[model samples]
Target: MKHAPDFLSQEHDPRDPNPWLAMYLDRSTPIDDEVKRAWLADSSSRSRQVILPFVRPFARTLIVLFQVLKFVTPRKLAFSRTLHRLLAWGMQNFIRPEANWLILRHFHVGSQVLAFIGANSPAPVETSPLTPQRIGDVRDDLFLVHDLNLYNFVIRLNRALHAAGRELEHVAEPDFSMIAQPGLRLEDMPDGRFNFLDLQSSIELFTPIYQLLLTDDDFWRATNSLQLDETIGLYAATILDARSHLVLLNNRHPLVPMSTLRAGFRLTLHGLSTEMLHKVLFDRRAAQEAAQAALFAAGG
Candidate 1:
């Protein structure tokens, strides 16, 4: 295969900026949009660097659990060891109340997780015995990757807020409330009644206009005072406190990775550097990139 010996220099074509080269090699780029995209996407490696250091102990426990679950001869003995290991893992991870506190303090955000609440945190409803086993259609289970990022931001915020001692009733409101300025909608839920709203699927559902909303100078000023971590925690705490008010379209879309939630309120804040989040919280680099690509493709 004749791969370009210096693929990094291929952007001489002028039309395509060849952002992926900058992305992988961490080289500098003249184009601002390309630079930001490369940075945000590159965080997978960064996340590994930060998170892998903390995961070895948990990993070892899992290895022990798997070994015990696999080869022990007596059923009762196996069950007992397995249960002990599993419970220990759970307590270390998410079962401890203090873990919940750290999650709120460090990693929550506004638009992602809070949208799932109903009038109250909806209790698990029993499916009907008459319901067909295959009642729901199974598909690839992929959603627009963009929505996942935003959704995660909100879910973490809610978890953090709950850890901070707020009730879901006291805080959460829809993104539309912040973006569109609407009054609260109250309703009932499995646990209790409180304020709520049924939200549509995907933050991108509002993408065409979300930029305009985000651009409001007043909004930026309002949110600017809070540090990124503090903001995320408050966002999550508010949502959990107002869990009854959230109406989430997709249930499978998780707020936090179950592993993180169970690991005791711990959060791995992913995607882009904190400096970048601050700079671009008021900007729309991704939307701008897509628009530029489309414009170039159309010969505009």
Candidate 2:
């Protein structure tokens, strides 16, 4: 016989706001007090918020740089030139008066390593695709380059916020309305390991954080299995207990719609693996030419 759904499934006060989050919290442990204490003293909190939203522009620039370096001869990108173009376009078209404040107010969380850094993930340098030789491309553009502008921006912004006396306390609440769900399933088989970047970045394991952000419409979108959703919810509960500011929604773009959010959730949860993430992030392209040359000489 089916027992009544767990207490969480019961309708509760909407004003309570984050019950899904709260239920998940109830099932977890508190983050280390030392971690919160360190964040409180550090001015990086405000800077992280200020610099995070700008990450997508940087990500787009980096993605292009990634593509360019892959195909460019000598494996040295003319990133400095492209970077100038990116910055001019970004400052004029992307960053604006209204967006300036909005960008500074909320912490950013996207589907890339930049997003992870913005959230102050425990490990940044290790997860970053940046390296010494490849770092030049990042330096080429302030707006379009794969450089450390975002990182520097965070530092400067933190100084400004510290002067203004703002600190980001980790938040917790009652609703599950805006959380992300898991995307991977046991049955997907050999194809499961395909998306390399997601795997290396721990995206597959972090599906629960994405699941909590899904809506009722999204909840019903599953035609094949609901197991991933449940797994995602449970997994999200675990991660949230570790980082409260890791808010649950894909970056909502103007042209995108409700369904895009679902797809983003699927991508975050279902299509990731640890090995793939490491390969995409740490796999250096600058050495590709030398490595391939050596291989060709030895074999063919």
Candidate 3:
């Protein structure tokens, strides 16, 4: 408790695992690894700061959802992997519409509202879903998403190209075919392939970062860029646009937190400032301090 009285001081340790730094620290010494682990722990503790500001407008509604869904969203049920697999499988299989454009628009483009749920990194870069007989020409080949970041970048770039009366497909082939070189697999991520939650469970804990993904350009850029190979992760969004499809699916509203229910969900992404995130991360008694603060506020 007394280790870090000052948030700014070097002595203060934040326990948040910075995604950027966490990507490294793998080959470090055991002692150094412990140091990084502590830092990551400290970083996460103050995650509230990064998340709260964005969700503040909807905090009240979130509380209501928790109260209402307490029965419907029992933690055990929501976090159930078996249940999530069933749902995702059902979505991918049971849904009808075999056409390329229709499928692209609805599932690939639309329903991404569920991206926060977990957009499985697209199909592996090496595997092209379209066979020669299926599409015939190289241009007609089908590319599946293995990396959401590069996929998103393609989506954004397509918007720019289309706006200028150009298109990614007609532009080039072998040069710009893939979005970016295949980098670390999210499944094989550096820090034990930490891509947040593996999947959306029926009762999963809420994370604000996913919600922010809808708005944070910086977040998008950081994630989507190419790896060393530069061509593997890249893809061109010729048929459908991602954000627009999201808007259309939402009836033209994207991440607006329109209803009280939506707003309520937003509140679940609690975050902490850099300083507070680190402070609580290192302090062994962070939870105790929070409890004390709550009790004091409640007239204890």
Candidate 4:
């Protein structure tokens, strides 16, 4: 049976609000005085990796530059679909491991950059009923992009499940309704290409982190015959989590309908993967061209 997240039930008073994100914390691991001392024992020894780094600002610059270029050349987005289909080809041909690794790494790094550096915090919630000053408060444009991102995510997630001999039986809806709906799907794109400069910079991936994010174990579980309800619940929980975060940030019940967030998450994931695949394919093509040129020169 589907149940609401335990976080919601943990609130002692129904009317009382939870202001912080307690979800990312490890509630099961409590630190006693001894444990606390042990944990802080190495605090004096510092490492350069702990800091987020000033280089993030530079990465932000490249991300924006490429984003603008991708938007301007619609063909890049189109070709991304063609290249992404190769993952299916690899699966059928028994090279699924490497293909999956490439996909996960590309996706993980791009998403990490976008999540940590590209995206801004949630927009200020417009609490007061519609007024002239608050007219701009309802950010339809912001939600449009969010919806696009979500829509892409769902398509890729379904594709991932499909490769594992499973599929998402249902798509979850969010609390907010979006005014603009995307009409196109991955299948709608024709094979094509645009400028490759948008992909010149490699997305920096930390292998350890992406390894942790890989869904190979989950895929193996699916091969044992996962049921429809499992997929439904997975997506349903995601929608609830997104809504909960929004509710916390806004500090008020959202006026938006649930349908919006659900659709957006699905769309964005698909789009994000497509963009990542395009970069990988572009780099591969460049390497092949250079290799061919060198071979021809040696022969001459």
| Candidate topping lDDT | 2
Instruction: Report the lDDT tens digits of candidate 4 across residue range 87-153.
Output: 2332223321212222233333333322221111121111111111111222222212232343344
Give stretches of model 4 more than 4 Å off: 1-55, 75-300
Candidate 1 lDDT over 149-202, as tens digits, reads 343444554565567655444322222221111121111111112111111111
- TM-scores, in order shown? 0.20, 0.20, 0.20, 0.21
lDDT tens readout by residue for model 2, 1-300:
012213334466667654333534351332222222222222123333354345434443443443444454433323344434443333233332222211111111112323322343222112232221221222343222122333343454456457767543322431222212122222221212221121212221222222222222222232112223232222233323432322332223212333322332344232222212212222222244457789899997
- Model 4 TM-score relative to the real fold: 0.21
Tell me the deviation in Å of residue 11 in model 1: 5.2
- lDDT per model vs. reference: 0.28, 0.29, 0.27, 0.28
Query: What lDDT, from 0 to 1, does candidate 4 have?
Result: 0.28
Model 3 error, position 113 (Å): 18
